[model samples]
Target chain A: MSRTRVQHFSISLDGFGTGEGLSRQAPFGHAGERLHAWMFATRFGKTMFGQQGGTSGVDDAILSTFAVGIGAEIMGSNKFGYPGWHENKDWTGWWGANPPFHTPVFVMTQHKRAPLELEGGTVFHFTDAPPADVLAMAREAAGGRDVRIGGGVRILRAFLKERLIDHMHLVQVPILLGRGVRLWDGLEGLEQVFDIETTASSSGVTHLMFARKGG
Target chain B: MSRTRVQHFSISLDGFGTGEGLSRQAPFGHAGERLHAWMFATRFGKTMFGQQGGTSGVDDAILSTFAVGIGAEIMGSNKFGYPGWHENKDWTGWWGANPPFHTPVFVMTQHKRAPLELEGGTVFHFTDAPPADVLAMAREAAGGRDVRIGGGVRILRAFLKERLIDHMHLVQVPILLGRGVRLWDGLEGLEQVFDIETTASSSGVTHLMFARKGG
Candidate 1:
């Protein structure tokens, strides 16, 4: 069975997945890169950024699972690029030419664009379909492997609210980003649906894994 | 030097200190005892309720610090009892005649009530003074010992907003109490003033320690 999973997602102590006032210049707005700082310190993150030498502890180990059985990814347009990215026709993505997602990357957007086949087998498929339909499409495209829910807070919250997520790994950073898009706003009584496990890393970040009950 | 500390404070993953619709019947509202379940499983919590034989790991170790070097406690009236607890004049507290505190416990309330000295040196003093004034009174009552900021969300937030808290220990429970009194509201950029450390316990609860800088 192909699981719909959310991996390596990060949120602040106050529950903000991304800070307020997101823009092209500030991808995470006032939050900046603070949420992903823990990931960047990991060996996986360092390798992803074409660097070397990072921690090989629990944080690194968890982040390294990004490609495990993941054949397709569904991400929100906001995550694919900055706001008003549709206006820029030349914008491929934040990645230069070869993106990290070596899978069928589904970008949920109202502005349809031709599928851009990038290097390393990463194909950006722009779609305006709803979560379930997109999931179906992604799952079919996945071809037996699992589907990954690439998020920018809004997308993940939608999937979670709809109970479409089968498994999730959230990194809870200690910093309190006072304002931003909250991931847990309407997610009340979440414990009833998911079996949760928490682990603290050496770098002072708590990793929470949520597995859907009986999924 | 005397420090104002908050110990054994529990909050939901969504940052709710206590659930909504609080009443006498439901002390923590819909959240019930879920937030403090981790603590209840600890030896400290079990012994506090006159029980025995519980886990004595990191969670227990942190909970056992409920009375370390504390001489006085300032808590909101909401924590003293439930909503409209003042209507019931004979109410001493929830903790029978023997209560837990072996020191002066100031109950912050608009209604004035005479001090009730219970068993085990626990005295409940009702005060309507502001946070600083109450802190001053509690500091004097502490007798050079560290003063504890006992919270029910509102009081702790007030002291925190005033930058009067010297240290705080927050247990982040995995459960999500959708609606309730939030703790992290308006407390943005708190990391700038305090150094935070995160540790995950065997009980699946993450312990967050915030030590005020230069305190």
Candidate 2:
């Protein structure tokens, strides 16, 4: 069965997935690379960025599961580019020529544009449909593989609120980004739906896995 | 020099120190015993509550610091009793005759009342003063010993915002309380003030210790 999964989604100690004032220059604003420093230090992150020499520990083990069975990805518009990416039609994404996502990437946006095919099997399809409908489209494109929910916090909360996520792996970084869009704002009593487990890594990030119960 | 410390403070993965709807019947509200379950299973908790035989590990080692070298405790009114405890003059506290705090405890409340001395060394002094003023009074009563900041969430956040805490130990339980008074609210850039360290315990709770830099 094809499952919807969120892997290696990092959040601050205060539950902020991304800090405020997200711009083209400062993608994560005041939070900078603090929330994602743990991942960048892992072997999986180093290999993903075409770099060499990184720690191969518990953090690397967890991050390595990110692209295993992922056949399609549904990312928030913010995850693709800055706030005003729509204004610049020529803008592709932060990922240069060949993006990491080798599958059909669905970008949830109000301004739908022509389908973009980048280098290395990566393709961007824009749509403004609701989560369920968009997810259905992504699932069909997954081709028997799992669909990944790429997040910037808001979109992840939306899918989570509707219980669309089957398995979620959230990394809780120790830094406190006192202000930002919080991921757990309306998710009160989330324990009722998902069986949660936590593991602390030596890199100062706690890995939390939430699997939907009876799904 | 007497230092202000916080220990054994349990919070949900969402950074909620206590859940909503706190009352005399449900102290932690919807959170129940889920947050403190990690501590209850520790050897220190078993001995503190007059029980026998509990696990002695990282959790027990952390929980053991609760009563050590602490002269006086300054806690929020919510920690002392349920909301509107001033209406019931006879209501002492939730801890019956002998409470765990064996020192002068100053309870911050708007409706100040006469001090209530319990069976044990716990004496509750009601004060409407701010954190700094109350800390002064507690320090004097502490008699050259360190003062502890007993919390219910709001008080702890207040002290943290003012940069009054010297040492803080927070246990991050796996559960998620979606709705509650958040502890990290308005405490933006807290990493700048303290050096934070994390340790994941076998009991599934991550211990986060924040020691004030150069303190």
Candidate 3:
């Protein structure tokens, strides 16, 4: 009964998961922190970053479930670091020494690197294998628990195209990012496979949850 | 203080306003009545089509605003009829004898045609003009009342690009039309000009309302 899930993924009104021109200095490019402002304002988000004083409403309620019942994570290389992260061997990640994901983290990339064991019980494993192969590895590492598919849009779309996602939660921010990596491009008619539900938060973001039917 | 507004314009979760392959046989193309099913379930929608016994909740409350406020309407030729409608001289419109729009409905198209006045005070005027010029005509016909910018996606986006819309209400339906005319194309950073708000109905549709900041 181990399921693959995606939680708290934010997208712009135009369906862009992240803005264009991502770099080391600007991890989200022109998007900055706009796409994640809602999460940052949540109590769960504040606590995750070792901060204090944040709202504990519906936004927080959803953000709190991000790490629940999920062992291990499969993230795209872009989510691991900026573009061309392979060139820099010293690039630990956007998160400092103490990372959030305490489980085994699998970073999907074409370039291979030795496994990195960071502080706070987080271990980074680099691989160039396809989605199904990577999922299989992550599922085994999950130890009979659900596997979380951490995304940077491309990898999420790939797993979704293969119908590997059991439960997906997408937070639709109201801002219109005219150009960027769109999340809904090729995944047309997705409602046919998933029973989608939407909840609008007071902070001007819509939470869309898609659960695979008969999964 | 008359303004131009769009209300109860339904689109898929993927931002598609209308599906592909629109013809006389299928008005909404592959989408059929799926996109507007939420509206049709509303009491206001049932009354519009001369039916009865429908829900009168938030969906009805929103759908009722489609015909509220002042005067004339501006719609794309595609909204008026199928493609190549100019070739058919007898093609009055998809709406039978008495169309829903009782005001002067201006149809924007490159091929000009004579004004076709139908029953119930619905006069169809064809003109090939820019957004401002067409707005001028519609405004004049509106007679100091607010003008409603009816859309088929393209015209709505054109008016939005020109920053002429004072208020816009878009209903995000749960269905996903894989292929269709998108409503949010080329409309980057639209949140800068408008104050946006969202409300999710129990019927699984989200209503997004945008009002011009200063207007």
TM-score-best of 2 and 3: 3
Candidate 3 residue-wise lDDT at A185: 84
Ten contiguous residues minimizing lDDT sum, candidate 3 chain A: A61-70
Q: B77-195, model 3: which lDDT tens digit per residue?
A: 89988988889989999889999999999999988898999999999999999999999999999988889988989999999999999999999998878789999999999999999
- Per-candidate clashes come to 0, 1, 0
Q: Write the per-residue lDDT of candidate 3 for residues A1-215, one digit (tens) a residue.
A: 89999999999998999999999998888999999999999899999888999998999988998778989999999999998888999998889998999899999999889999999889999999999999999999999899999999999999999999999999999999898899998887899999888999999999999999987
Question: Number of the top candidate by TM-score?
Answer: 3
Which is better, 1 or 2, measured by TM-score?
1
Which DockQ values do the candidates obtain, in the order shown?
A: 0.87, 0.72, 0.85
Model 1 misplacement above 4 A = none
For candidate 1, write residues B81-191 as lDDT tens digits.
977889998999898989888899999999889999999999999999999999999999999999999898989989999999999999888898889999999999999
**Higher-lDDT candidate of 2 and 3:** 3
- Residue-level lDDT of model 2, residues B7-50, one tens digit each, is 88999988888888888889988888989998789888988789
Better of 2 and 3 by DockQ: 3
Q: After superposition, how far is residue B187 of candidate 1 from its true place, in Å?
A: 0.7
